[model samples]
Target: MNCSRVNLKNNTLYKIALGLVVAVSISACTTEPTPPVETNELPCRVAGYFKSQDRVGGFYRCVWNASINRWIQYPYDCPRGLEFSEQLQACVKP
Candidate 1:
């Protein structure tokens, strides 16, 4: 009988190589999203002071005032004593 032996296991080396590759791949995958660049400037000049009265937890309303030449924000509630005349188109809810 010939008494000879050969080691046929290389699990430790394989595991180390795999771990290094996984670590490198994970590090390469981390990146921050780029912010969008602003392309245009405001066209209209702010004529007067405008205030927004939107409620903390409710829908928002936008109003374009041709008189004051600026957009104003109003609360979700309907204006007092104003019978929401469908003709004026006063309030815009978004």
Candidate 2:
């Protein structure tokens, strides 16, 4: 009915809208971030580097053995204070 009353109502609506936007934004980001997928299968079939299922500082080198006619998973460990990185395909400082 009055100017002050109209301003009060408008202020209340603005606050409610801002709060709603903030709540939605917070809720949207509340979900947990997914972790990086790791491969943990059996004997390697391809000749390449693969992630080790046992340790973080370890990895498996899949090599083709002509005599055995199959691939071999040679377990290897990184140097002291290093970790295996999938992106780099080598051991790196964590």
Candidate 3:
């Protein structure tokens, strides 16, 4: 009878330990997802900008330097009396 009681207690303890382990495992797997980082600024206007292509809007294609983390403009300068136009996607006399 004592042996049977011991076996029952051991079995109960083992089941409790297994239940705790399963609960912990499930909690570990249910973490909330991380939020995305926002990057609102334009890539071309940042310092250390690198031109990627020739004039698209009277401005060379450019990218913001990853280190600087700011908007950057293209390298080519617009001609006098003209300006680069985003809507026109080219340099304009206006």
Candidate 4:
């Protein structure tokens, strides 16, 4: 019919601990942050495509002959696929 002071203290501690555990568990269940969405605004620089650092002749951005250009089929995507060779200053096929 009566509760002891110690019992009240233990109940409060247990509630606090349970609340913290629930918070931590919910946070842990959070989804990984989605990668920033790629947008058309992102510069389609060829060097951006070649992330490799060790290779000397890694893929470079360059424009290809309109006839041979794969993007030619998708003219809307033009320039997006245009690769540039900084050394050559000319468009090169990616």
lDDT of 2 by residue, 1-94 (tens): 6999999999999999999999999998896533333345467778888767777687777778799786666677788888888789999999
Q: After superposition, how far is residue 29 of candidate 1 from its true place, in Å?
A: 0.4
Q: Which parts of model 3 have CA positions greater than 4 angstroms off?
A: 34-94
Candidates arranged by TM-score, highest first: 2, 3, 4, 1
The prediction achieving the highest TM-score against the true structure is 2
Backbone clashes in model 2, listed as residue pairs: none
lDDT of 4 by residue, 36-71 (tens): 322333233332332213333333232223585432
Give TM-scores for every candidate, taking all chains together and pairing residue i with residue i. 0.27, 0.50, 0.35, 0.33
TM match of model 2 to true structure: 0.50
Candidate 2: count of backbone clashes, pairs at least 3 residues apart or interchain = 0
Off by over 4 Å in 4: 37-94
Candidate 4 local Cα displacement, residue 16, angstroms: 1.1
Show how many residue pairs clash in every candidate, following the order shown: 0, 0, 10, 8
Query: lDDT per residue, candidate 3, 1-94, as tens digits?
Result: 6999999999999999999999999999996633323333234443342322344323444445468865444355567767677666666776
Candidate No. with top lDDT: 2
Question: For each candidate, what is the lDDT?
Answer: 0.43, 0.77, 0.57, 0.46
Stretches of candidate 2 off by over 4 Å are 1-41
Taking every candidate in turn, the Cα RMSD to the unseen true structure, in Å, is: 17.5, 13.2, 17.0, 15.4
lDDT of 4 at 10: 90
Model 1 lDDT tens row, 1-94: 3333222235666788999999999999998633322223232244322222233222223456789866554333345433332234443333
